[model samples]
Target: MGRIIAVANQKGGVGKTTTAINLSACLAEKKKKVLTIDIDPQGNTTSGLGVDKNMVENTVYELFLEECALKDCIQPSVMENLEIIPSNINLSGAEIELISMENKEYLLKNNLDAIKNDYDFIIIDCPPSLNLLTVNAMVASDTVLVPIQCEYYALEGLSQLMHTIDLIKERLNPKLEIEGVVFTMYDARTNLSSQVVENVKENLNKKIYKTIIPRNVRLAEAPSYGMPVNMYDSRSAGAEAYRFLAEEVIEREDEDAWL
Candidate 1:
């Protein structure tokens, strides 16, 4: 079975979508088959992979509703080895709609199990909330990868997310584990960024990814052009950071297997 990782952060603007898009791209670039599931209603991950929302026929919304097969919803991205299950504004209503269903939290998990082995990794871009959608993602995933931005109030937001993960592990998915914590938008020129990293290491017992994503103009521009930073500007800081992040992820997998 493939490793299903949910790239989640309850706090928005923390580079959650950016990590989902670029990390998946880089992993695919390494010749590993990767699938990205855009569960966020914002659909940023969908667009970031050069998937046009206006033309999507099947999406995660339909998959949750069991309106289509998982294979029907999977769309190949611009990258050769990467695939995506696009999401759009239609997903915004899923939370309220799912509330009336039996075993709603397991809906995504059950759907994903059918095709888990098709790819080496399945990365989910979760919405920025602790609602049913996030619960479903947590329950479906083997691990949660959190992206913490290097800014004030970073640790404050992390506490709440950690608590939610604990609750999910306690009652929902006992197999759920924290994949790792990645620092994003870091500016080494400032003492604040350095301090934030130090604070995060002090507070969380999770492994902090060695590759810190620096604040880069290229990263912000890539999504507008419907491409990942690596394809947009392979030599850019953001691109290099994500590439290194992918290496760390692969290395961790090897380490885990050995353990």
Candidate 2:
């Protein structure tokens, strides 16, 4: 079965979509079959992976509304071995529509289950809120990978995010676990960045990946070109960091398998 991970952080601008895009790309580069699900209505992940979200005929929104099959929603990305279930602005209304539907939380889970064994990893990019879509992502995923930016307010809203995960684990998905925490947009020149890292380490009792993503201009620029940092500029710090993070992810999975 595939290891489904949701890259989630209710706090926006924390590199959640960035991590979701690059990590999935890097994993695919490593010869792993990867699938990315863009649950965020902004469709940033979809566009970041070089898919034209506005042009897609079938999206997760259609899947949720039963207008299309799960397989129909899957589209090939620019990167080999990486597929995506694109989402668009239309998904923004799914929350209200879901409320009236039965087992709304399991809608994503049920669809994903049929395709679980087809890939090695499934990465979900969740929205920046604890809405129904996020709940659906959490319910469908095996673990949640949180991206915390290295800034002054890095720890803000973390507790509530954890609490939401706890509730999902307790009520919806009992097997759900926290994959780990990754530090993003770290600036080595600033003492504040290190301070925030140390603060999160001291406060949060979650596994912290050793690889820290630096704030690189190339990283920021790659998205506009609809390419991952690795594909855009493999030598950039941002690309290297995500590659190391992907190795860490695979290594952790290997260790878990051994355990």
Number of the predicted model whose TM-score against the real structure is largest = 2
Q: List the residue pairs that clash in candidate 1.
A: none
Worst 10 residues of 2 by lDDT: 250-259
Off by over 4 Å in 2: 254-259
Clashing pairs in 2: none
For model 1 the TM-score comes to 0.97
Across 1-259, the per-residue lDDT of candidate 2 in tens digits comes to 7999999999999999999999999999999999999999999999999999999999999999999999899999989999999999999998888788999999999999999999999999999999999999999999999999999999999999999999999999999999999999999999999999999999998888888999999999999999999999999999999999999999885644221
Against the reference, the lDDT scores of all candidates come to: 0.92, 0.94
* Deviating ranges (above 4 Å) for candidate 1: 254-259
Q: How do the predictions measure up, each by TM-score?
A: 0.97, 0.97
- How accurate locally is residue 205 in candidate 2, as Cα lDDT from 0 to 100? 89
What RMSD, rounded to one decimal, does every model reach?
Answer: 1.9, 1.9
How many pairs of residues collide in each model?
0, 0
